[model samples]
Target chain A: MFPVFEIFGKQIGVYGIMAAVGFVACFLVGRLLIRRYDIDIYDFALTMIAAGIGMAIGASLLYAATNYRYLFYGFSHFYEIGWSGLWMCVKTALDGFVFYGGFIGAAIGILIYTKCAKDVKAHRDHLLDIYAVLVPLFHGFGRVGCFFGGCCYGIESPFGFTVHNNHLNPAINDVNRFPVQLLESGCNLLIFLLLLVLFKKHIMEKRLIYLYLLIYPIVRFSDEFLRGDGIRGSLFGLSTSQWVSIILFIFALVMLPIKTKKLKAQSAQAAESDAD
Target chain B: MEQQQGKKGFAIASLVLGIVACVISWWGLVLGIIGIICAVIGLILAIQAQKSYKAIGQKNGVATAGLVLSIIGLILSIIGTIACGIVCAAGTAIANDSRIANQLLDQISSSVN
Candidate 1:
């Protein structure tokens, strides 16, 4: 019902609009990072444009795939399947946006673009450091978009934070859902601010990105419990994302020590070479 | 010179093949295997060309193109595989439901008669 919005014969949805708003916010934040850090990646706007195109394509593809039944059969076979059929499919896929899919897609896009540039490979360390911070800032915008679209609604709660009858979908009708999306958006905003503060103090580098890798998965895993409509099914008695989070958390922890050792060794070598 | 061009041609051909595989079929196990091949070759070429570009004090636009194309191709193929998974899951669900429904209806009819 809250699917389409028409203005001057042009149609849009809260999902798409909020996504765009998120992108704009990300662009502005990226611009701020550029000025603060003296990053010399192409003009900020061009980078934003390229990233925007990549995220848009990747997000829509993931959404369509995750909800393939709704996207193809439900929407296309309306005459044969009827409204109920389509509704079921839509409800099935409307639980939330797939974050892993978006993360992987955007990472590939940024890595390719950066590697292709003439100077980027030479400045790989600095470029990566800057990107580490930018990722969370941009991700914060996406969580906000998720909040407005009401896709990742929360489960029932006695707390007053529950959202009732969002009207975005029938499946979540009259339930006091947890507002999990809002919680995520808030956490991401805090993470973004923390990254900003760390970057200002110059205490962040590759380590900062590692922190994000640790923090986001933990947040997502905890929030997974509150999600009412999405893929909450257990795999080995744990939700899929929670399991993934556990795996990723361990991976990040293992990598942290290795990364720190590598950095130290490199710095020592540089110092010896400089003395020579 | 011709061999290098041929190699570049081969890489480009694979990249295009991968893209089409991703766009049309969008989901299949085989597409991912092929996509991996395309991405690997493309990545190698891109890195090699980048080294050559540095040696010559210039940029390698062709190699960059290969990298970008291969990356997009890889992403699309991966997406296609995921789509295939969702399709399989939905199909299985519907099939199971129909089977259960028919069984229940048969049991009820037999009992009533």
Candidate 2:
């Protein structure tokens, strides 16, 4: 696994490079989408800033939440661990992020933007629908990043890659493991294509976000089963992501029909008013 | 007619901060943290600048540049932060477990002999 590579005597992470590429990709795609969807450019930019802030906060908080025991250990052994040691522990603890948390955070971010910007509030669903498509697009690149870095690795398997001398991920060194990151990346690609098609076709005009919520959780829930990493916290025999998946899946299931019914009623009322 | 000096100043500040962030991102964790903060502030400034430009019915290319640079800086800063964190963790582990270090030294000495 090539976690970090040297360039001009500076170490650069494969994960960071891929994520940066993903952001650029999203920006390019969002530019086109903004025009297509008639979204205000200024509002779009502000909303993205808000979402970026929220995603970072949410992802980091969840990472720290899952590893709170380490914090407790560091706190209790402050003298023993030393300031630098405690700082290192905090850094290591925060190095990991959960995508589900970022998703929730971005959603909250959009909600806040809608509330703050009345002009954009009218087009909330449109904004959400487009952002939904972008999520999978960005995540596709992110999963690939995770693969080269050997962070979100798969279970041990005979038919997989054997990583060696990976100091960044010693756990994966000399072991042949399932390529879950690639699998998830592939899944995200498929989801992205399908969502793009739906959005372009105007098939699920205002409900694309719910569609994403419906699909990704199943993939994530299954992904947890194949993940070999034991860093994330577990509850009731299920990892935090698994629990989040169940909640998001059920939320989509419940919210979809309600949203559909509301949209239908609003359309019917508009049609009647137009005829009158 | 677009004389929002404060907004233009924000855009300029964002651009400068973004440049600063990218430059410092390669220095590793401690400076990486500072780089990240600079990038975040730059991003906020870019967003605000964009708002001001839009309010005046104009697009500010400088703010867009700032936005892009800030993101790139943020990514690089994260990389530096994690890279140094890894180094620090490794150092701590070796300090805590001298056995591994001793084994390595013994391996080297036996090879030399």
Index of the highest-DockQ prediction: 2
Candidate 2 yields a Cα-based lDDT of 0.78
Per-residue CA lDDT of model 1 for A66-159, tens digit only, reads 4454445456656655666565545445423456656656656666666776645454555455556777766666555555545555787865
How many residue pairs clash (N, CA or C atoms closer than 3 angstroms) in each of the candidate models, in the order given?
A: 2, 0
lDDT of 1 by residue, B1-113 (tens): 73433345544554565455445433344555466455545544555454545555665556667656755664444333322112222221222355643453344334433
Off by over 4 Å in 2: A79-82, B1-6, B54-72, B82-113
Residue pairs whose backbone atoms clash in candidate 2: none
Clashing pairs in 1: A154-A178, B26-B80
Q: Once superposed on the true structure, which residue ranges of model 1 sit more than 4 Å away at CA?
A: A1-4, A35-37, A41-96, A160-168, B1-113
Q: What is the TM-score of each predicted model, taking all chains together?
A: 0.61, 0.85
